[model samples]
Target: MQVHECVSFILLKDNQVLLEKRAQDKEYDPNLIAIPGGHMEHGETREQALFRELEEELDIVPTSYVYLCSLYHPTGELQLIHYYVITQWTGTIVSLEADEVAWHSLEANPLDIEADKVALAEYRRLSLSLIIL
Candidate 1:
């Protein structure tokens, strides 16, 4: 089986994180609420893909971000997902691809995808460790 790689980001600002409701007609996770991101194209590095995806999905360019972790999951399509926490960015955020988007409290656990939930837990762990350091 061929494994596909992708990147997802948690966009953070002022104690809130950006979340999106995927379009109901999307092929993968239709109507699910999760952080916004997309798959990598051929010949692109992870950061390149990240930047492109952020631009395409959110209409913003991330200026600051940190890699959180990667996860492997086998669904109909196998995936190796690289997750990141983006703390700073430029341009106003407007959802260009999702059905709807909003900012939610950082403490809220509202994500609907299992991979997203695991990625968020890893983000929270890293955030706490940073505060202690």
Candidate 2:
């Protein structure tokens, strides 16, 4: 089986999070709601892929973000996904690839992919810890 390296960003603003519905024709997770990101290109570091994907998908460049976690996912194919939390960014959002995009209540946890669910749990835990600190 072929494995791909991927990077995804969870964009947080106020009490909402940005999410997208994958393009209906996508090979994996078609029309599923998900965080924004794509596969890493050859020779790119995780952060590099993260920033590039942000720009490519949403036309935004992250000004502030942090690595959250990584997960191995098997959907249409195997994927090693790196997750990030983006707190700040520059540029207006213009969806370039997804079928739809929207801001949703963070507490709603609107997601479809199993890997995304696991990543979101980690995000919530970290956020609560930050608040408690």
Candidate 3:
């Protein structure tokens, strides 16, 4: 099976993380709350893909961020996701394909979210250390 590369951004503000409710029509994880991200395109670096995906999905450009870690999902197809913690960005977030976009507290239960539960757990565990002062 081919392993695909994807990128995700954890945009945090006021101790809360941003999440998007996937559109019901989405091929994967429809109507589930997840971090903003998408598959990486050919010839694009991880950062470039992150920027492009964020723009396409939310119309925002990250100004500052830090690489977090990568996680693998082996549901149907193998997927490797590169996660990042975005500290600063420019432009208002507009959910183009998602049904809704909102800021959720880190303490919010991740069980309700259908995608990347492990990554969420990891983020919560390392947020204090990963966050820039």
Candidate 4:
């Protein structure tokens, strides 16, 4: 099985978090809300991959970002997901790939939305440090 690395960013503003709904035609988790991100290119570093994915999917460039954590799944095809918190950015958001995008209450229950629960929990758990960093 091939191992893949994926990067995601949680963009926050005024206590709300930006989320993107996956296109209905997408192969995995169609119509599910998720953080903005994609697979890393062959030679790209984690930060490079995050920047490229954010640009491609949201048409914005992060002015500053803080590494949150990584998740690894060993079942079936191996997957390693790197999570980041983007404190600032440049350019207006344009949904280039997601089906829909919106800002939801940061304190909202993750189960109430179609997002990645694990990552959401991690973000909430580290919200304080993330803001301080």
Candidate lDDT (C-alpha), each: 0.87, 0.90, 0.81, 0.78
For 26-112, candidate 1 gives per-residue lDDT tens digits of: 878889898898889999999999999999999999888888888875656888889888988999999899999999987885898
> Candidate 3 overall Cα lDDT vs. reference?
0.81
Model 1: lDDT to the true structure? 0.87
TM-score-superior candidate, 1 or 4: 1
Top TM-score prediction, candidate number: 2
lDDT of 4 by residue, 1-133 (tens): 6878888888889888888888889765567667767889999999999989999999999998888888864433466878888879999999999988899887773332323567777777766665544
lDDT of 3 by residue, 60-129 (tens): 9999988878987664567788988887999998989889989988777443443466777777777568
- List per-candidate RMSD values in Å: 1.7, 1.6, 2.0, 2.7
Residue 113 C-alpha lDDT in model 1: 83
Clashes of 4: 0
Candidate 3 clash pair list: none
Q: Give the Å shift of residue 100 in candidate 3.
A: 0.9
Please report, as a residue range, the 10-residue window in candidate 4 with the lowest summed lDDT.
Answer: 108-117
lDDT of 4 at 17: 83
Estimate candidate 2's RMSD in Å.
1.6
Model 2 lDDT, full chain set: 0.90
Model 2 agreement with the true structure over 22-127: per-residue lDDT tens digits = 9989988889999888999999999999989999999999998889999988987899999999989999999999998999987886799888888878888878
Model 2 TM-score (2 dp): 0.94
